[model samples]
Structures are given as structure tokens and as C-alpha cells.
Target chain A: MSLARVHNFAISLDGFGTGFGQSKELHFGHAGDRLHQWMFGTQSWQRTSGSRGVDNVFVRDTDVKIGAEIMGAGKWGHPGWEDDPDWKGAWGPNPPFHTPVFVLTRHQREPIEMEGGTTFHFLDTTPAEALETARKAADGKDVRIGGGATVIRAFLAAGLIDHMHLVVVPILLGRGVRLWGEDIEGIEKDYVIESTPSPSGVTHVTFTRKA
Target chain B: MSLARVHNFAISLDGFGTGFGQSKELHFGHAGDRLHQWMFGTQSWQRTSGSRGVDNVFVRDTDVKIGAEIMGAGKWGHPGWEDDPDWKGAWGPNPPFHTPVFVLTRHQREPIEMEGGTTFHFLDTTPAEALETARKAADGKDVRIGGGATVIRAFLAAGLIDHMHLVVVPILLGRGVRLWGEDIEGIEKDYVIESTPSPSGVTHVTFTRKA
Candidate 1:
């Protein structure tokens, strides 16, 4: 439906997606890597990242549905390096998500080349603008909000998202950056719960938006 | 030996500790159940919750560790009831935490007993006051900052914690609640990476208070 759906925006249970005052060294901070356990074992990610394996139906279905992805600059890790053109896409080698990605940033930079069909488009655009661009590029597929928290919250606070898939891994990053801030106010969310447990004990839940 | 340990608090990667509006029904929210996957499989939780004959290390450790606990009125999802002599602890049949818990609420209530050693104490004390009471009641043990977000944040901001174990679940709950607010400023955290994976693919990271 061309709606902006913030799919799989991983944040810390501590209300942070990334730690505060983020630098390149602290992308997602401390135990931030723990959040991606679900993706690593998934066929969608494995195939894209170049691995040969039998696929789990649930993981496969969930992975291929994503069409476009967006993230804030912090999620992207760096924004002021446009002049140097030294920025690299967060994923190394062949990245997952063989789709277009829109990165929200302040400084304008050239598009980043990535493996697979993924391309990192740095946009100084507002949330609405990025959503619109992502929607157009998504080609009827869902627009995934890959985030560092503030970016996703912006879209969510504006009520622009349609669905969210939250995978709750069981690790805690006590401190670093927090994605959710109390400064945000005036919002309501209604979700239908769809939960499934992988053999590894990672619970994958899909929250379809209601109103 | 009291130090402000990083990772003492945990949050759902979706940025909510529970559902909105602080309603009792909203205690865990739709996906809130997934947040406690670690403790659910813990031996301590299993034994206390009456899930015996289940051989699992994670479950056993988490259960016995929280031998006693506490909460605030706001976290209990009920107020005024705390003033009653019959105020009971949350969880039915057997509560989630099998230990004795002292809750810090403005309302004073009699200690309501449960099937297990778990009891609810509604205290009108402040953060320090509650900690003093909790420490004594903890049987010279670790006092868990069983949270409703605000309560945990209060203790954290007050520098009253020793060690924090944070499990970063792998999902983003785009909207609902936040852990820290803009009003919470100038706080610092340091963490060491103690990352291990649970059977459920949930990473268990332990953070000690850095001197």
C-alpha cells in the first residue's frame, strides 16, 4: 500500500537503539551486536550474505517481504564525512537486503555502492520526504525502517509506520545509546501479536498496526 | 563497594518496558512476554513458578537469583491498593520472581504473601529509602531493580546500583514508552563486553560497575 512500515528496527531494551554521543567505534554500542542473532540464522540474510543452506519457512517469508529500508544517520554511524567520501556501508562483503536503502542524514553525500542490489542513498530529506521516496522505490513492497531509534521514533511519532517486526534477543547493553527518549509525547499504538520461537530460543514477533 | 554498574537495567529493544497508560492489563503489553525469555528459561524462575523437571541452566540461575524482589506502585499497575493491608504481589499461582520483593510506592500496604517466598511490600519511601529497606530484606543478596522504567531509571540516575545484567532483545517496538528522558542529563556509563548466547539465541551480557 506504499505505507512506511518500520520493520525490524532493533533498539536496546534500555530505550536505546544506539548509545548516546555515538561515534564510529560505538555503532550500536557494547553488546549491540547481540540484536542481530535472528537475522544471522535466517535464510534471507544468509542467502544474500552468500551462504548455501536450507531455509526455515518463517524466516524466509519474513526476510523476502522487505522491499526498502531506511535509517537515521547515527544508524548509518557517520554523517559529516560527505566531503571525504570515505564512508562505507555498515555491512561488509555481500550485505543482506537486496533492495534500495535510504539513509537520513544532515550532510549530503554521494550514494554508497554495496553488494547485492542494495544501494545506500544519503538523504537530507525529512521523515515525510524519505518515506515518500522509499515508498516509490519499494515497488509495492513494504518499506523497512532500519534505525538507530530517533529516526524510527520520528516516523512513529508522526504516525507514518504501518507494521513492526520486533525480534527480542535476550541480551542487555546496560549503557551506550538509547533509541527511545521520554522527550517524545502524544502517540498511541495498537498491535496484534504474532509470535514464533526459533530453535535457538529467539522469539520473533510481528506487530501489525491497528489504527 | 557500591558502584554504578552499566547494563544494570534492561529494556525491550522495541523501547517499551510494558504497554502504554500504565494500566494493569498493560503490564507486559503484547510483545512484553518475549522480553523475559532469559528469566523464563532460568532454573530459579522455573522452580519458583512450579515448572519443575525442566533441566535448563539459564532457567535455574535466573530463578534462584531473584529469591527476593521489590517494585513501585506505579509498576504494580495498581495504586490505592498499596494502602490496603491485603495488597498482594503480582503473578498468580506462582509469581514470576520467587523471591521477596519490596515495592516503592507512595501508598503503604501490608505485606501480601504469595505461594512462593515472593511478597509485595508497598513502601512510601524514596529511592534511597527503598534501597536501604531492600538491601536488608534481600538477605545480604543482590537487589534487582525490577522496573517499570521510571523506577529503574531513578535508581540508576541516583547511582545506587552495583552490577547490571542487560539482555538486548532483538526487536524495535516503534512506539509506547521510553527509558530515559531529556530531563535525565549528564549521566555516564561504562561497560565491559561479557556476551554469551542463551539456548534461545538471546545474548546474555554481564556488565560490572567500572571504577
Candidate 2:
């Protein structure tokens, strides 16, 4: 059985996944890269210069055994991405996700086959429907929930996530898209939560569903 | 010079200091004792039966050299506390705070002297003005900010907090009054933030002002 996993999802001290006023140019808006600065210093991000710490260990797990990816429209491109037919996503030619990536959006578009093995498949579906589509595309492998906050929160609210790895960054982004909503109370009852604070000043929190 | 400090301030993973709809019966509202279950097992709480761990270390620091305290009216009493003129604080006769504790409220009342050196002084003043009264009453000792979120947010917005110790419990109180607000975006630039996660599933976060 394949799992619906979320890895290396960074949030501010205030639980904001992305800052306010996120635009085409500024992906994280006023937050900049502050939420993910800790990962940049890891060996998985540097590839050649960074140190092999707990952060690097978690960063490397981003690509481990994950087949297809499901992300919200905001994460695939900017706000007005649907208007532009030539939107190639935030990642360049060869995206990090080498699997068949499913983009959940209201405005549907044909599958765009990018360089490398990555292909962007647009779908207008609910969290459960999208997961079913992504799971089939995954081909017996796990499906990674590539988030922009809303998508992850939806999946979480629907009780579809099996494993979630959230990194709590030490800074507070006062205004942003918050991950935890009013419907998320008692969500911990379904999962075994564990938190480990690394020396780099970020705490890695994991919620693994009890079988 | 005496500094303004905050200690043993517990918050949920979502940054809620206290849950929504707090009443006289339900002090923390929907959150119940989940936000503070980590402290209940510590030596500082159980007196004779608790363990001496990192939680106890920070818990014991709550009353270290704190001559006076400033807390919000919500922390002192329930929502409609002003109506009851004869109501003492939640913490019986001999309260935990053995100092001049100033309660920030819209309605002013005469000071109530409790047992164990805890005197509740009601004041209707701004964070700066209230701090002035507390500092004078502190008499060369540090003033601790006892909070229920609003008062702490006010002092934080005013840049009057010299030291802040926030404990992030693993639980997520989905709906409640949040500690971080829009005015606190670049507040991290003023202090050195440190995060230490204990085995008891709580992360102790400290913000020390740069000298």
C-alpha cells in the first residue's frame, strides 16, 4: 500500500506556510526565503558544500521513494498562471519532481511534458479525487503532497495524509497562509507526533498515522 | 537595570496561547489542559512526584527573581469578571505569584491583597503606562509578563519585552487568540531566538534582546 506523504514542509513560528501577498515574482511574498533558509544550508540543497546534519537527512528524504506529486495551482505557478498558456512552473526546464506531477486547479489545461521525466498534469478535482488520480499515476509508489498551504490543509482536513513532515522555522511570519485551521483540532489523535529540534534552529515535526 | 521577562508561557503548535471561548469553568476553553500537560509532569508542578527534566528547568525559572507581574484581565479572571466585585482570582487565596501582580483591564478596581504576597492591582492603561507602574512596583527586580495572549501581544508590539520564553507544545489548538500578529513581522530582528525541544514533546523557545 502506497502512502500519501508530505516531506520538508516549512512553516513559520506562527504556523504560516507562505507569507501574505504572494505573487508571480515573490513566491513567498514578504516572507522571502526566510522560511526555507535552514534547508539551503543543508547538504541536500548545496549538493557539494553543505554539511550532513539532521536537516540534510530530512532534505534528502524529499525525493526518496515518492512517485507522483499533487500540488495546488498556486504552487505550480503564480496567481495568473491559468491566463498564460506558456507557464512552465516555478522550477526551470528540469523540475525537482521527476514524477508525473498533478496540479489541482479550476482552469484545466493539457498535460505539459517538460524536460527530464517530469510531466505537469492539470486536474480540477477534490482532495480525495485528486489523491485517487495521483495514486494511479504513482504506479504502486507513494504520492507526495507538494504544498502551497491550501492544498496540504485540504488533504489534512480530509484525513488522507499518512505521513507528514513539517519543519517549524524559528521566525514568525505574522501574516500569511496559515497551515492549521479551526477544523484541525484533535487531528493528532490519528497520528503519532514526534518533534526534534536540530542545532540549525529548526524543529522537524513528523506525524505518522497509527496503523 | 531590571529587565522585562516572560517565562513558562505555553502555546500550541499553531501559536495559540489559550483556546477560544474561555470561561470561568473552562479556563483554556477547547484546549483544556492539553496546552499545559507538559508542565504538569514536571518537578515544579508535582512538588514531590515529578521528574527533574528540561521542562522543570524552565518551569522553575518562572518565579526566579520576578518581583512583579503584569497580566491581562483574561488571565486574572473570566470574561465577565468585572460584574462580580467580590470575586478573587482563579488561584485561590495563596496564589502562585508572590509579588505585585498588575492586571490590565478596561475597568478599574481597588487593589486586592491576597495571601502569599500576591496583590492584584487592576489598571486601565496602555502597555507602556502599565509597564511603568509595574516597573516602579518591581523595586529593582525583573517584571514578568504573565499572559493570556492579548497583553503579551501588546507588550511585544510596543517593543518593551526584553526577554521572552515561549514553550511550544506539540498539540494544535485550532481556534483561539494567536500570539503573533501583523505588527510582529520583523520582531525577530530585535532578539536572538533559540529553540530547544525536550523529550517531553514541548519546544522551549527563547527570545533574548540583543545588547
Candidate 3:
């Protein structure tokens, strides 16, 4: 079975996945890159210059067995990205995700093939349908739920996530799109959670669903 | 110089100090004891039966070098506690805080002396005024900012907290009063934050103001 997973989803101390007033330029809004500075310091992020530590270990785990990805529209591009027909993803020509990436958006567009083994497939479907499509594309491998918070919350609310890796950043974003909602109350009952704080000052929280 | 500190204040993964709909019976509301289960498991909690670990280390740190405590009215008593003039406190006749405790409330009442060294002093004052009173009572010792979330937010907003020890529990209390607010957007710039995750599935986050 292809597992639905979320890897290295960073949130502020106040549980905001991304800061308020997200724009085409400032993807994280006022938060900037504060939430992900820890990951960027890891060897897996820089690939050549960063150090090998607990952060690198977790960062390296992100791409392992991730054959397909389902990401929110906000993550795929900036606001009103659907309106732009010539929109290539934020990852330039060769995106980091070398898989069939399913972008969840209301306005569906034709699949766009990129430099790497990546293809952007836009879908206007429900979480279950999207997961099903991503699972089929995964082809016996795991399906990664790439997020900007909303999509992850949707999948989590639907009880579709098998494994979740959330990095709790120490800084407080104050106001933004929060990860946890009322629908996710008592969600811990379904998963066994573990927390590991790295020397880099971020806590890695993993939630694995019960067998 | 005495510092204003917050110790062992447990917040959910969603950054809620206490859950929504707080009442006399349900002090932490929907959160119940989920956020505090880590502290309850520590050696400092049971005193005789609990294990000595990271949780205990932080738990023990809670009472060290603290002469006075400044807590919110919510922390001192339940909602509508003011109506009952005879109401002593939730900690029974003998409270845990062995210091002159100042409770921030709109309705000021006469001070109540408990069996322990704790004396509840009701004060209708601002954060600065309350801190001034607590600091005076502290007598060169640190004044702990004991919280139920609102009081902590007020102190943080006022930039009165010198050192804060926040425990990030694994559970997500989907709805509650949050610790951080719009007034504290760039508050992280003032504090040097440190995170340490314990085996008990909780991360102890400490914030020390930059001098």
C-alpha cells in the first residue's frame, strides 16, 4: 500500500505554517524564511556545504521513497497562479520534486512537463480523490503531501495521512494560516507521536498512524 | 537584579495554553490534562513515585530562585470566582506556590493566606503595575509569571517577561486561547530561544531576552 505522508512541514511556535499576507515575492509573508532556516542549515538542504546532524538526517528522509506528491495551489505558485497560463513552478525549470506532482486547485490546467522527471498536474478534486490519483501515480511507492498548510490540514482532517513529520520552529509568527483546526481535535488518538529536538534549535515531531 | 520568568507553562502543538470554553469545573477546558501529562509524569510532580528525567529537571527549575508569582485571575480561580467572596482558590487550603502570589483581575479583593507560604493577593492593575507589585513582593528574587495564556500574552505584549520557559506538548488542542498574538509579531527578535525535547514527548522551549 502506498502511504500518504507529510515530511518536514515547518510551523512557528504559534502553530502558523506560513505567515500572513503571502505574496508573489514573499511566499512566507512577514515570516520570511524564519520557519525553514533550520532545514536550510542541514546537509540535505545545501547538499554540498551544510553539516550532517539530526536535521540533516530528517531532511534526507524527506525524499526517500516519495514517488508522487500532492501539493496545495499556494505551494505550487503564488496567489492567482491559475490565471497565468505560462506559470512554471517556483522551482524554476528543474523542480526538486522528481515525480508526478498533483497540484490541488479549483481551476484545472493541462499537465506541464518540466526539465526533471517532474510533471505538474492540476486537479479540482476532493482530498480522497486527489489522494487516490496521487497513490496510483506513486505506483507502489509512498505519496508525499507537500504543503502550504491548508492542503495538509485537509488531508489530516480527512484522516488520509499515514505518517507526518512536522518541524516546530521556535519563533512565533503571531498571525498566519494555522495548521491545526477544530476538525483535527482528538486527532492524536489515531497516531503515535514522537518529538526530537535538534541542536539547530528546531523540534522534529513525527506522528505515525497505528497499525 | 531579579527577572520576570515563566516556567513549565505547557502549550499544545497548536500553541494553545488552555483549550476553549474554560469554566470552573473544566479549568483547561477541552484540553483537559493533555498538555500537562508530561509534567504529571515527572519526579518533581509525584515527589516520591515519579522518575527523574528531563521533565523533572524543568519541573524542578520551576520553583528555583522564585520568590513571588504573578498569575492571571483565570489561573488563580475559575470564571465567576469573583462572585463567590468565600472562594479561596483551586489549590485548596494549602497551595503549591510558596510565595506571595499576585492575581491580576479587574475586581480586587482582600488577600487570602493559604496553609503553605502562598498568599493570594488580588490586584486590579496593568502588567507594569502588577509586575511592580510582584517585584516589590519578590524582594530581589525572580517573579514567576504563572499563566493560563491570557496573562502570559499580556506580559509578552508589554515586553515585561525576561525569561520564559514554554513546554510544547505533542497533542493539538484544536481550539483555545493562544499564547502569541498580533502585538507580539516580531517578539522573537528580542529573545534568544532554545529548544530541548524530552523522552516524554514534550519539547521544553526557553526564551531569554537579549540584553
Candidate 4:
């Protein structure tokens, strides 16, 4: 069976995956790119110039076989990008994700094909339904959960994730979207967790689903 | 020039220092000793026969020169211990804290002298006031912030904590008292942060105040 996976998702010491007041100018609000600076320093995100240390090892799966990508509306575009007809996405023409991207949003729109084999499909469905659609679209390959915390938290609550890689940054983003919530207590029972600390002041924690 | 420091404080992956329904039986509530199992394995807490690994390094500060400790009332006793006059702190006859320990609460009580060098003094005061009393009791030595989350969070919010050591456990407590709250945003600016992951499935994060 193809697994549901998440990779290189960053969260603060307080578990905030993204900060509050996100906008076109500040994609991560007051947090800016503080949460992702570790990933940026890795060749996985840059694909060219970066470190070859412990961080790169975790981020090395940038070219993993992901048949489909499921992301939230906030991660797709700004807060109100649905009204803007010209907003194809934050990515100029070609997004990093080269798969059938399922954008979970209440404001459903027609699928928009991007460069480099990336396509955006809007959906207004529940977590299980969305995962089912994404899995079918994945076509025997793994389905990647592209997150902004809120989306990943929902999938986690729904118990749809099989493997997740979370990079816990040392920074404290006081207020923002949390990857963990009160609704998903004892979630650790479903998976075996391992953590590796990087020299870049980040802890890479991976949770793999139990057999 | 005594510095205010915190050591070996444990919290869940969701940042809950302690779980809900804290009673006499359940000192740490639903969290029980799950958050502290790492510390329990360390020679620092055991005083003998424990692993001498990376985790032991962080927990090796049991003999640190701390002349005084300030903790929350919840840490001092159970639910309604104020009603029961015979109640001493949870540490039993001879407490672990061998110094002047101040318990913050509304109902003031006479000092309870334990078998060890520990003396419990109940006081109703603000964070600053509590620190002043602790510092005096410390008498040039360092004052440790003996916490139960709420007390530590209060000190952090009041800008009274000079150094803090937080151990992040991998468990997810769906409901509990969170150490990091929405009120104290952007707390990272005041300190220099560092994280080290141990094989015991815990990340030891230290925050030292900027000079």
C-alpha cells in the first residue's frame, strides 16, 4: 500500500507550524522564514548550494516518488487568493511539487496546470475523503501531505498519515497555527518516533506508523 | 548577582507541562510520570545506577549550588491540601529540595520544615515578589525555578527567568496545562536557544538570557 507522508515540515519550539497574520507580503506572518531557515540551508530545498550534514540527510528525500500532493488553501496562496483570478499560486509558473496537487479549500475552482508537471486541484471535502481522492490520484505511489500545520493537524486527527518528518526549530513563535492539538491526544501510540538533532539548532523528529 | 535558573523541566510534544485532573493521587495528572521517565532513569535523580549517556549529561545538575527554590502551590501539594493541616509537599518526609522552598498560593501558611534541609514557606505574591523572597533565601547562591508549568510560565512572562532547561517528551497530551501560551509570544528574542536530542526520545532545549 502507498503511504501518506510528510517531509521537512517546520514547527517552532511551541509547536506552531506557521505564525499568525499570514499575508502575501509575509507568507509566514511575523515568523517570516525563521521556521524554514534550516531547510533552506539544506540541498533538499535549494537543490544546489547547501549543507551536507545531518540536516541534508533528512531533507535528502526531496526527489522521493510522490504521485500526488495534498496542501491547504493557505499554503497554496495568500489568505484570499481565490478571489484573485490571476493568482495561479505563490509559485511563479512551476511549483516545486511536480505532481497532481490537491488544494483543500472551501472555495473550489477548476484545476490549473502549471509548468514542470505540477497541477492544482481545489477540493472542499473532509480529511478522509480528500486523502482517498489524493491516494487514487497517486496511482500506487505515495501521497505527500503538503502542510501549513492546520492541514497536517487535521490529517493527523483523522489518523491518515503513515510517515511524518517534522523539523522542530529552536525559535518560539508565540502565536500561530499549531501542528499538534487537543483533539489528537495519545497519537503517539499509533507510531514509533525517533529524533535527531542537527548542528543548525533544529531537531528532526520522524514518526513512522506501526505495523 | 544570583541568577534565576530552571532545570530538568519536562513537557509533552504539545508543550503541556502537566496533564488535566491533578489530584493527590495523580501528582502530574493524566501525564503521570510519563513526562519525567527520562529524568528518573538519570543518575542525577537516582544518585546511583543509571545510564551515563547524553541524557545523563543534562540531568547531572542534581548537585548544582541552588540555595533556594520557588514553585507553584500545585507542585507543593495536592488539590485541597490547604484544608488538610498535616499536608507537607509531595517529596515525602525528606524532600529532594534541600533549601528554602517558597510555594506560591493565596492561602498563606506557616513554614513546614521537612526532614532534609528543605523548608516550605507559603507566600501570596507576584512573580517579582516571589523572586525577591527567593533571592534573599538564596543568599548569593542561584535560585532555581522549581516549576509545574504555570509557575514557570509566570516567571517567563514576568521576565524573571535567567536560564531555562526544557525537556521535550514525544507524547501528545490532548488536554492539559500548556507551558507555552498565546500570551507570551516572541519570547525567543530575549534568549539564545540550543537543542540537543537524546537517545531516550527526548530533546533537551536550553535558553540562556542574552547578555
Top candidate on lDDT is 2
Q: Largest TM-score belongs to which candidate?
A: 2
Predicted complex 4: DockQ: 0.80
True contacts kept of 4: 0.89
* lDDT by residue (tens digit), candidate 1, A1-211: 6656655545433444554445566565555466666567765667656323322454455446678888777766544445556666667756676888888887777777688888888898788888889888888887888776777767766667677655544344556555454443323335454554445544555556775
The whole-model lDDT of each prediction reads 0.59, 0.90, 0.89, 0.89
Of candidates 3 and 2, the better by DockQ: 2
What does each candidate score in C-alpha RMSD? 8.8, 1.0, 1.5, 1.6
What ranges in model 3 sit over 4 Å off? none
lDDT of 2 by residue, B1-211 (tens): 8889999889988889999889999998988888888999998899988979899999998888888999998999998988998888999999989899999988899999999899999999899998889989999999999997888988999999999999888787888888888887778889988888788888899999999
Model 1 misplaced regions, further than 4 Å: A20-22, A42-67, A77-80, A92-97, A110-116, A183-188, B1-211
Give DockQ per model, in order.
0.10, 0.76, 0.75, 0.80
Q: Write the per-residue lDDT of candidate 3 for residues B1-211, one digit (tens) a residue.
A: 9899999999887778999888998999988888889888888889888869888988899889999999998988888998998998898888999999998889889898889799999988899999999989999999999997889989999999999999988787888888877788778889999888788888888999999
Q: Interface RMSD, all models, one decimal each?
A: 9.1, 1.1, 1.2, 1.3
Label model 4 with its docking quality class: medium
Give the lDDT of residue A173 in candidate 4.
82
Candidate 3: TM-score of chain A is: 0.98
Model 1, B1-211: lDDT tens digits are 2232323234554455554544455565554565666556554555656334322443344444443555656666554453555435456767766666777765666676777566777688778878777777766666677676777667766767566565545444445545655434333344333445444535554555556
Give the best candidate by DockQ.
Answer: 4
Error of 4 at A101 (Å): 0.5
**lDDT tens readout by residue for model 2, A102-138:** 9999999989999889999999989999999999999
Clashes in predicted model 1: 45
